[model samples]
Target: MSVTPITTANLLARQLKNLINSGSLKDGDRLIERDLASQFSVSRIPMREAIRQLEQEGLVKVYRNRGAVVKTLDASDIDEIYQLRALLEGEAIFQSMNYMDTETMARAELVHRLLGSASEPTQQGLYNREFHELLYRRCKNHRLLEMINGLREQIERYELFQRRLLSDTLKFQDEHEQILIACQHNNPAAARENTVSHILSAGEILKSYLLSR
Candidate 1:
């Protein structure tokens, strides 16, 4: 689903995001517009748009005359992203506890089950993305969503990277299920703490991966 055969930038961006998120086009990887366009059977224009989207998300950097390259995030980047997510998404999750309907909650639980049952880490990663997106859908804060989306983008590779390296996704699943249960209880404090702990745990795992790299 992330790898689209189309040439449009939106599709290209989505597919490229998925690649970056899934650890295919890893940190510091150069993304050639021509090669990507050729691979996707599209034109340069859409590929450029796709690059721009990644640029906005802080996943890719563009130079004056050169093409784009995936960012090799350092400690500062992770720190900033985690701090930002703490302020914005922590609130979002707290607000979401009050706003979520039973159907939506059930859907999120379904995502949890799906993530647990996924055959591979890649599928589990995708499920993780969807699960979080669903959790914050009721926040009613467009700017907050945008910010969290970028933060999530910044950490995607680390998530997949750590899981593959450690071969341990069950821990993540356990944490998420706990967070979801907190939401189910309609307890804002519990949801916020659980969410913060979840993000912090991810930061620690990702920190290990970054240090290893």
Candidate 2:
């Protein structure tokens, strides 16, 4: 297997994204460039590039003089993002149905099993992402996949929040199973419907939790 090259900027970006998703970097917290560079042992250049990438992903907002602050999400932000996710992910899964092979289906099943065994919400979330990515990897539209990934990253923090309160990983697993079953049966329309329902249900649950906070 060929190894994918990892860049300094991408590495820094992943670390920063982890901080945000884990809530170590709180919402609206200012990111000091020099401090982060020192912490990560990188120069200002790659740090800035990572910040720019996060900003593009809606995780950070850079100001003229104030520098970068973590973007705070309200209930409305959660609603809008998930709504977009429902639409984009649903369509992507539908398109991928024709292209999905047996190998990908097996991989997805493996990830789903791992998700069931993952005790930590963060680990579960990662496995969940892998499961969906496997299902959607065959999507022919590169741009749509890119957008879906961006949205997924943007909403990961919210997913972490939801997982803290909701212990219904089994329900999510069941939904994932339904989607997989649709794929196994070669039912694209059923797969699309299940995916959209799963996303929208997650959105509603997250929205209610966010509003209650």
Candidate 3:
């Protein structure tokens, strides 16, 4: 299999994406080409390309004369995304549970352990994604998986904010364990319910934070 080449633009895009997801780059922050290029020791061309890539991912918006600014989601956007995620991911996990094996369960448990131990918000986010992806990996519906991933990406910034600003990480991890237990017991219905509950709970916390700000 041929590997995709990583260019300067791709590297820059990944860095910018991480910054955005980690809450270092706040919503509506401008992507100043000159400043970012100097900071990253790159040319303006790649910086422009990087911002364009983030724009494509719905993380950045570009206006005619204003360059790119980080995209901010409103309360409605949060509600819609989380509602869709609850439905789609709930279904995905239910379907995947039908095909779950010992190995997948074991791997998921490992990821969950890692997630609980992860101190940094970014590291916790990564392991959390891995744990959920592992649980859903056995689902045969590739399109469904793609949709779930897309929705998760859209709300990731909010998730990072929730982790950093709220005291709910431990509560969330407890919910994760509950989901894992349901999956391990081969109870698809309970797993689905737990998964949906976990997502909606996180969404509510985020929405409350956003509105209070």
Index of the highest-lDDT prediction: 2
Task: Return the TM-score for each candidate structure.
Answer: 0.76, 0.83, 0.80
lDDT of 2: 0.89
Model 1 per-residue lDDT at 152? 75
Clashing pairs in 1: none
Query: Which ranking of candidates, highest TM-score first?
Result: 2, 3, 1
**Model 2, poorest ten-residue lDDT window?**
161-170
- Predictions: Cα RMSD each: 4.7, 3.1, 3.0
Q: Tell me, by TM-score, which candidate is best.
A: 2
Give the poorly placed runs of model 3, Cα more than 4 Å off.
Answer: 110-127, 164-174
User: Can you list the residue pairs that collide in candidate 2?
Assistant: none
- Return the clash pairs for model 3, or none: none
Q: Name the weakest run of 10 consecutive residues (lDDT summed) in model 3.
A: 160-169
Query: For candidate 2, lDDT tens digit of each residue in 53-172?
Result: 999889999999999999987889888988999999999999999999989999998998888777887777678788899999999999999999888888787777656533564678
1 or 2, greater by lDDT: 2
- Between candidates 2 and 3, the lDDT winner: 2
Tens-digit lDDT track for model 3 on 7-60? Answer: 999999999988987789999999899999999998899999999988887789
Give the candidate order by descending lDDT: 2, 3, 1
Candidate 1 lDDT by residue in tens digits, 91-197: 88887776789888989999988877776867776788788878888887788888887777677667757556324547788888888988888888888888888
